[model samples]
Target: MRVVFLGLAVPNMNEYHNMFTELVVEFRNNGHDIMVVAPTYDEKVFGMQVEDGIPTLRVPTLELFGVGKIQKGLATLLLPYQYKRALKKSKIDLNFDLVMMPTPPITLVNVASWLKRKYGSKMYLILRDIFPQNALDLGMMNPKGLAYTYFRKKEKEMYFASDYIGCMSPGNIDYVIRHNPEQNANKLHLLPNWAWLQPNLGQQEIIKIKDQYGLLDKFIVVFGGNIGKPQKMENIVALAKSCTTNKDIFFLIIGGGNEKEYLDRMILREDLSNVRVKDFLSREEFFKVLQIADVGLISLSENFTIPNIPSKSLVYFNARVPILASVDLNTDFGTHLEAIGAGLWAEAGKTKKLKEKLMYLYNNPEKRKKMGENGYQYFKNNLLASMAYENIISRVTNT
Candidate 1:
């Protein structure tokens, strides 16, 4: 099978740790020819490159990350055209059996439709982010405005264009079906986020990394990945403020995003000495930190009406760390955690309940150990790249 993957951003083939990259590697390992088509704002990095035995076409695109909503919206609106133009100019063959893409820039619908028409390709949507609705959830977009209407239309087009829609969870499948009655129910299927599982870091290496970061002798509650609007970072700040008197409990925030300044300001304004914020770390560095950390923290905004199963949870699962989540009511992530005995969760704005769950994990070392072990076992059994690969291949081939 020859597959072409289109995404907003894709790392070089050498960096194959993320969900999409891992999935791509699985296809290649199974003797399928795969190519990546992604956008790059850096002119120096634009054009095609064969990285570590994979052909990747980096089409020049406007800056999308770390920009204001207006600018970001414009960039997203232009992405499909940019992709189409680049693919037309490139010498790489467009005759692919499958065309795969992840949502975010839903405008990619046009390009996917074009490819399907031109080459008779099967279009598969890896639904990671549900846009327009998510923006409305965060109060970032006016529901009645033109921008919302435009993206909502694009979202529908993307869904209708897809041959199969892979949702992150059961709640997502339900939401999509209930809201978008035009979509075929049989087309929606579960495709949870996955990672390439790696072995845990040795104790000495973990200790060295902890000491280097001045995180030694602390009950570290680490929140990694994007610190964006959907994260509801204030809840984490409130928790840190409440735990200020407890010298043993420390908060470590890793990753950068639009709301990073807000988090920094709140920490300083509240005189929080127990919290530390660090920029994004490499995969290797983050894994070491996860290994040494006592708990993994997940925070989602209370305003969300759509269920979001954060991909970061896979990192915690792979690292064998217990999770303490404060998420929106719509998300079934909390239920999944409790079912597997891998973590605890409370509604996003319920500070008291969140504190209780956090403290329960903090006070019970044996329980934490058991939960971490359970999570790692579950990841091995259900959430590996190979499992996701088989799921996708079997569906595509059978169809």
Candidate 2:
């Protein structure tokens, strides 16, 4: 099948391991032609190139991220127009069987609709980030305001344009259905976040990473990825603060975002000796460090009405690391983890409960190892790239 994948992220397979690259590679291996129509802000003109044997069309637009909120909003609002104009100028082949896109801006309905019209393609929506509502839940946007109304309309348009909507979790599917009663109920399906599993690190390499980071004898609890508002970093701060009494337990935070400075200040002001903060690591180094991690961490704000299953969890699962999740009650993330026997969880604001869970892990290595193995097996059976590819292809092709 000829497919066009659309999103804000442009995956360079050599630089990092991402789900999109895994899906693209698998599709190509199965004899499918794929074109990645991704946004690029570095160039002023639309350009085309072949990367890793797949055609990538880079469309120039007001850059997303690394900008203020207002500018970011403007860029997101203009993405569809920029992408459409760029694609038209390319004069490339438009015969596509399926067109897949993810939600962030929720402003790509125009481009996806155009592709569907032009090629009679089946448009698939990977509902990774539900918009306007997420903003509303975070109090980032007023639901009754004009901006929210406008984006809500666009969100509906995207939903209507999609033939199939693959939600990140069952909770996500429920949220969409409850809020958007007009949407086709049959279209939504549970599609968990996935990662391409890499080979396990050697014991020597793992030891080297542990030693280099001075974590050789510490029980490492890692919080890795974007330190943004939705993460409700206060919970992480509280967790870190509570662990100060236990010198054997360490909080290793690796990631940068709007909230990094806040975390930095807190760590410094409190003289957090048990915690360490570092900028984002290279993909190779990040994976190596994952080997020494005793537990992987995921955080979500209590304010979020939407159940967000962070894609970061998939990385931990790929590395066979058990999760320590602090998410809202509405989210099924904790429930899923418990069901899989892969991890423990506590509510976002329940620092006491989190401390108890942490102590449990500290007191029990057998439990930790068993949970990590269960997580790895669960990842292989449920969240593998092959599973996602087959599910998507089967649905779209009725195969």
Q: Each candidate: what lDDT?
A: 0.90, 0.86
Each model's Cα RMSD: 1.1, 1.5
Candidate 1 per-residue lDDT, tens place, 2-73, comes to 999888867776764577888888998999999888988777887787876778888888789999887888
Worst 10 residues of 1 by lDDT: 9-18
The reply for model 2, stretches above 4 Å from the true place, is 44-46
Which candidate should be chosen as best, given TM-score against the real structure? 1
> How many clashing residue pairs appear in each of the predictions shown?
0, 0
